[model samples]
Target: MKKNKIPYLLLMIVHLGLFVVTIIKKKDKKPLLLYYSGIGMAYVFEYVVLNIFRGYRYYPKVLKRNRLDSVFGAIVSQALIVPVSAIFITFFQLGWGWKIFFTLLYSGIEQLFIHLKVFKNRWWKTIYTLISLPFYFWLVSKWSIYLDQKPKKWIGYLTLFFTFWVNYLNINFVLVAFLKRIIFKKGWSLRKYYVNFIIAPIYGFIQSIIGVIVTLKNKKLIGLGLLHLVDQLFYRLKLIKMKKWSVYCFLPIHIVLLLVGSIFKQQMLHLMSESECSQRETKKIQSPI
Candidate 1:
């Protein structure tokens, strides 16, 4: 049976449109940062429910493997649509009525996808989405505020986490799933993708921390050496499998990730400085002489 991709496309297009609208309408707040961070945070939530526990399934027909396809669908809805909607509501300062509207909107869309058979539920229900979305929306709204507040400590930590997370997710997917480079043993599922994806958060921010410090301290070579030694240990312990690709081969990847994490830290700090400066200027202008 031929599956309709129009629905998936339409869903993505609408959220992307919302992102654009939010960007244009809320220029001063760095909508892009908020949008992507929301996606990363929501991605974590979906990873737990959809990937780890298998709460539901999706038939987006977007990937060859059913599991991967379902994951893709989940990403579309949870990572993109949910976050985009939250940002839209926050930027516009929409009222409770609008909040209710988006909550029901997601529930309706989930039901529609289920009816179309492009999505299915194993243990999850549309009602759960209805109940959970309000909280998620509120959280994102508050989070956006936090991201702008004096560039707080958690703000930097979060920026580092998500920036490294997104990059790590991409790099790991390519290496473990597609390139056949690294594999983590004892995956909850038989699939390596699930295993690596699940364990990423565990080592993710730690690697981010390494990346930032190593680059800042100019410890790239030693840092890479230590990580490779750890991989060698994992290999010896049968905790991970490296095929055709050796621990030596991962040096470049580590280097890239290290640089990525470090660069993200630099960029985020720069943005925070700019935000603070802007706030001070606004305050000075508003104050009477």
Candidate 2:
């Protein structure tokens, strides 16, 4: 076995042991959905930062040149690491001191991974991990408590928004850029501009409103829409240049993400309703009937 692989293998083993203990000992089932929600959100964040944004790389590369390796790696991290960490942080009822201790310990382990060449940082930094750990723990802790009381539709909405954003960034930015450069024999040009920057955002705005009709609909699309709009605006303002083919490339990718987002939104709603029903039924059964 490669030396770098040793750390990941050991971590996976420890994570599996922790999960087994959690299943055997955990009494409260309320946090289950919250755990899943955290995992989903974390996956989206990692996809955007590491895969789309090219913030870092895993040494030896998970799955070795497979295009889907990033997705696989994200799932693995969430499955083997995120849930266990969240569960322990929530379960232990640790004080601030212990929380800090665990945060530092986690950061230290990450540093060890860096030293072992398990991860190579580009735009990523250890301090960022140190800062984010506590926030993640606190977020999961609150989520566990909140889900026990009411079903928050906003959580589902946010998840959908992030999901769409992740797909949009990766497909439009990474995949398209790579294909255009290699296969099309195209170089980044100054004269071309992206039409999806205008069209998709408008489409997303209209679809998100007509479909969801929620207050957050506008809020969700605005930032993404503006990001796209601003890209075009930069070209118009002569602040940046783009290739003409860039617009064509962006259109289909945006269309795909929009379609996927629409389908995903419906599925999320159905799942949320079903979960809510199951929780209510459990409550009734446990009530003084």
Q: Give the number of the best model, judged by TM-score.
A: 1
Could you say which candidate leads in lDDT?
1
Candidate 2 residue lDDT tens string, 90-140: 766665676677679878877877787776678888898788878877887
All-Cα superposition RMSD per candidate: 3.3, 8.7
Cα-lDDT of candidate 2: 0.55
Report the CA-based lDDT of candidate 1 relative to the real structure: 0.74
TM-score of 1: 0.81
lDDT of all predictions, in order shown? Answer: 0.74, 0.55
Model 1, span 15-129: residue lDDT tens: 8899888888788776766766777788788878986898988787766767556666776776678888999999898978899998998798888888898778889888888
TM accuracy, model 2: 0.53
The true-versus-predicted C-alpha distance at residue 175 of model 1, in Å, is 3.9
Clashing residue pairs for model 1: none
> Model 2, residue 132: displacement in angstroms?
0.8
